[model samples]
Target: MLPFGRVAIIGLGLIGSSVARAVRATMPTVRLTGHDADPAVRDTALRIDLVDDVAETPGAAVIDADLVILCVPVRAIAAVGTEIAPDLPAEAVISDVGSCKAEVARSLAAALPDHAIVPAHPVAGTERSGPEAGFATLFRHRWCILTPVDGTAEPAVERVAEFWRRLGATVERMTPDHHDRVLAITSHLPHLIAYTIVGTASDLEQVTESEVIKYSAGGFRDFTRIAASDPTMWRDVFLTNREAVLEMLGRFSEDLATLQRAIRWGKGDELFDLFTRTRAVRRSIVEQGQDDAAADFGRTHD
Candidate 1:
């Protein structure tokens, strides 16, 4: 049986449009309805025929949906939940694609007290945005974490899991708090570091901007790619998951200080050991199929 016959996606950004495309590719008979706050985005979605229907309002999008996935910023979840609450079907399962889960759970619960809220975070995306930037295979081989609060019906949670599985994602469940902490270290902190590094490079007075661009190495180029992610989305992610992010940041700062001291004191053995361990981590990620081991991260050069 199909997990959901009718689906509504609120927000037509990269994730939202990708979901629409994935659904169409994997489950052609299932109906898809989508809405975005920006009229230009809505027009683009319509032009691309991204969904079966492009709704003008959040409520309208979910009026007949069996599943409504909010793809908006974490800070906007509560408002969007409230907007769609009135028209949401009684048995519809509400999920989201936001990275932060604890706050999303609280926001959805407050906005729609009677609904089944299963917050999800798809651990996949490129440094791209907008309806036109999506692809049907974005979720293939990715992990989608579902954080369903206590008392959420088992069937509803399973349905959400099955939905993701059909889209070629491996689904796993975690507590909202645990999900926040794990993602804080694995995803959020990395983005934060990337943004900081890229920003610092740009603000250096010793190097001209054009010179920095001209001499950019592989590491800095990768950081710049991450820093190019949507500012609004990253801003909300940092704010919504501040506690965990801050905790992780503190730990990172201490580790960085240790590395700094090692470099200053000529502790070659200490630095070598740390680098060896970190290199193993990269190898492990590749072994687990989470990343490519191809030369230069699978990039092609002419």
Candidate 2:
């Protein structure tokens, strides 16, 4: 049986549009409804025929949906939940794509007290935004983490997991708190570092802006790509997951200080050992199929 017959997506940005496209590709018969806060986005969604129907409001989109997925920023999850609560079907399973789970779970529970909320984070995306930036294969080989509250019904959680599985994602379940902590180190901290590095490069008085751009190396280019991610989304992610992010940031700061001391004192062995261990981590990620080992990260030098 299909996990969901009618799916509604709130927020027609990259993730939302990608879900609509993935559903259409994998489950042709399933109905799709989508809505976005921006009228321009809604118009773009219609122009692209992104869904079976583009509703004018959040509530309208979920009125007949079997599953509703919120793809907005983390800070906006609660307001969207409250907006759609009145129209959600009694048995509809609610899920979201927000990175922070603990605050999102709490917000969702508070907004829709009687609903079966299954918060999810699909660990896939690019430094792109808007409806036209989405592709049907975005979730292929990606991990989708589901963090349902303690008392959520098993069937509802399974349905959400099955939904992600059908979209070509491997599903894993974890507690909201644990999910936040793990993602803090794996995802959030990396983005934070990227933004800081890119910002620092831009603010250097020793180099002219044009000079910085002209001499950009591979590492700085990659950091700029990470920093180019949606500001609103990252802002909310940092704020919503502040505790875990801060904890991970503190650990990172201490490690960075150690590296600084090693470089200053000519501790070549210490630096070499740390670099070797970290290089193994990159290799492991590639071995697990999480990244490409191709030369220059699969970039075409031509």
Candidate 3:
């Protein structure tokens, strides 16, 4: 059974468009409408047939939607909620794809006090953006975390979870605060570090951009990929999830200092042991199917 008969998606970027594609792929019987803040994007969505219809405004998009998924940036989630509140169907379910769940949940709760807001983060995406970058298989074998607050209907929560499952995501439910803290460590901090590493590299290589490009084949390529992610989306994530990010960052700094000391003091055994342990962690991730051990994220394995 389809979880939602009529679905509307706000913000037609990679995630939003991907959701549309996945929905059409898995549940062709459901009606899909989408809206973007940009008219150009709307045009492209229509040209590419990204959704059944492109709504002119957020208000119009969710007027008859049984499920409304906010795929906007973290900072914009609340405002988008306000924009569609008047048009949101009385019994419609609300959800979002924001990285920071706690803040977004609070914002949505304040905006739509009567709705069942189920904020979710599909731990799936590439360092890509825009409507054209989406694909139906983006969430395949990935995890989707749901953070439904107290008072949200159990049936509504399950419906949203089932929706994600149909899009090829394994679903897990957690409190909004815990979801934010966990994502800060697992997703936010890693992206922050990737951006920093790429920036630092570019700064140091300013005098010789050519050679930096030459050596990029070794390791810089991956950092560049991560750093290539959409700027606006990542910016909001860090700002809204600052508390959890900073907490994880402090621990990271302490660990970095320890590693530096080990290297400086020529503690070969300590360095070797740490490397071995970390290597096992990577192997375990591959074993669990979170990633593949092959190069190019198993893309080239074929």
RMSD of each: 0.7, 0.7, 1.5
lDDT (10s digit) by residue, model 2, range 1-302: 99999999999888999999999999999999999999999999999999999999999999999999999999999999988888889989999999999999998999988999999999999999999999999999999999998789999999999999999999999999999999999999999999998889889899877887887774688888889999999999999999999999999999999999999999999999999999999999999999987967898978
Off by over 4 Å in 1: none
lDDT of 1 by residue, 107-221 (tens): 8999988989899999999999999999999999999999997889999999999999999999999999999999999999999999998888889999887887877764688
Candidate 1 displacement at residue 146 in angstroms: 0.5
How high is the CA lDDT of each candidate model? Answer: 0.94, 0.94, 0.92
Winner on TM-score between 1 and 3 is 1
The ten-residue window of minimal lDDT in model 3 covers 293-302
RMSD to native, candidate 3: 1.5
TM-score of 3: 0.97
204-253, model 3: which lDDT tens digit per residue? 74457677778897888888887899999999999999999999999999
How high a TM-score does candidate 2 get? 0.99
Lowest lDDT 10-residue stretch of candidate 1: 211-220
CA shift of 190, model 1, Å? 0.5
Q: Name the weakest run of 10 consecutive residues (lDDT summed) in model 2.
A: 211-220
In candidate 1 the C-alpha lDDT for residue 295 amounts to 68
